[model samples]
Target: MGCDGGTIPKRHELVKGPKKVEKVDKNAELAAKWKYCALSQEKLRRPIVACELGRLYNKDAVIEYLLDKSAERPNVEVVAHIRGMKDVKVLNLTDNPAWEGERRNAKGDCYEDMHCAMFICPVVGLEMNGKHKFCYLQTCGCVFSDRALREVKTEICHKCGDPFQDEDIVVLNGSKEELEKLQKTMEERRAKAKTGKKSKKSKGVETVSKPSEAKVSSESKPGLTNGESGGDSSSSDSVPGPSSSSKTAKPITAAGSKRSIQQMEEKSEAYKSLFTSHSSAKRTKDQLSNWVTHTPYHF
Candidate 1:
């Protein structure tokens, strides 16, 4: 055993170390994020859209997802947050003049550039290949780089000249932290809209009930007057009230019954006895005399 081949092992060789993390190609990652649709994994084309969280997608891909949500898709998680078309904004892109299209290498004659972009920023002339930060206006759908907006600070859009506020700016392809912030802002806006609708409904109900309450009060006024005046017809008739025709009720038999004139405080008792209903108006046959029928001149 006298050290024939140095059989003693080092601690570094005996124990295994953690594996090194693999690095993703930066250029390929950028190409995937900017050039390909998040939902369908297809090449980005005209009428591209960006969601509220700033994830880019093809317009056709989003529509397909909404049409058949039960169908299987490659990237279902990417579109899980999008509920409808309103959650996304169609991008307004500016074409790059120098870059040729897919047929640029039709003859296979020259070098192909993978970094070249189809669109560029209208204000700063920067190619939108994920190297420069870009944002779109929510009001006009115009795209511009962050540098252009920072250098030329104004409320008006540089591309469309339309007026917009700070809240209307939405960044394209934002980071995770930025997306979380955007998600919170969206939820707050929806909550506020719901509260506003509820308040309007309550106001409408109050307005409808006011007329009904006024109608009930008007009908009750005539009843109180009739009770206080001992059913006097003249006094009850003088008070103005709503017409009885509007109510869905038939006239009661008691409504036609009139109080005897003797009960009326306004008329004299002597005048009340002249009515046929009074006891003085009746006479017995034995007590009847014919003196009033004879005229002295005619006799």
Candidate 2:
């Protein structure tokens, strides 16, 4: 079969064995996860954010995705759990001193380093180039390598010194199993928040109805007292409420019920004199101005 028809038989064409599974390149996979936005698939720029699953994304890209959720997106599964901006945290990245960024090799005299990253761990100084395991604190959003976290044990963040718990540490570019665990935690948190909001709303409604209930009780008690005998009126008035006692007390004055200002002993004599109602403020007949006839000689 090999020499038939003066044709060459390639090794691939003759092989009828089971197909070999193709493996993804580790370097390319790392670059995709660490150096690019998970949502838009663009190069990671300033104002980078991370979701609950520790996936990195550009802030603007995340905003656009949130704004137009109905639009078709290839990487929707990555950000499907993200509800809004509150679902993500902005990373506080540390700049790498050796990284030249876009103008890395302008002279072209030296070999370019493909593993170079713009940000690195402030504690261990490891480049965030996927070679090292990195995690960020949810409390402070400070990125640090896993090695540094294990070496230096503390509740305070290494970069910002913000106190955090074990639950606050989220792994960056984690495995599929880790991502699923993070997703489950995120769902539980949102559900807890929803229950809290509902409880607050119920409390608010109960408080608002209390004032109206008191008003109804106060109004009904007076009507019941009017319908009963004299002996029962006193017992009916004892229905305890906020304003029932104040409403039941009748004003004894027949007419001119206004209290006299002179009865107020707390006022100073000078302060009382400023008012026209004071005895001192009333003018005598001698101090009053007389009405005069208009004449040029009078001036």
For all candidates in order, the CA lDDT equals 0.83, 0.86
Rate residue 179 of model 1 by lDDT. 82
Q: Which stretches of candidate 1 lie over 4 Å from their true place?
A: 1-17, 107-109, 226-299
Which is the leading candidate under TM-score?
A: 2
- For model 2, how does the per-residue alpha-carbon lDDT over 133-199 read when each residue is reduced to its tens digit? 8999888899999999999999998877799998888999998899888878888988999999999
Task: Itemize residue pairs with steric clashes in candidate 1.
Answer: none
Q: Could you tell me every candidate's TM-score relative to the true structure?
A: 0.68, 0.72
Q: For model 1, state the Cα shift of residue 174 in Å.
A: 1.2
lDDT, candidate 1, at 284: 84
Give the range of the ten consecutive residues with the poorest summed lDDT in model 2.
247-256
The C-alpha local distance difference test score for the whole of candidate 2 amounts to: 0.86
Candidate with top lDDT is: 2
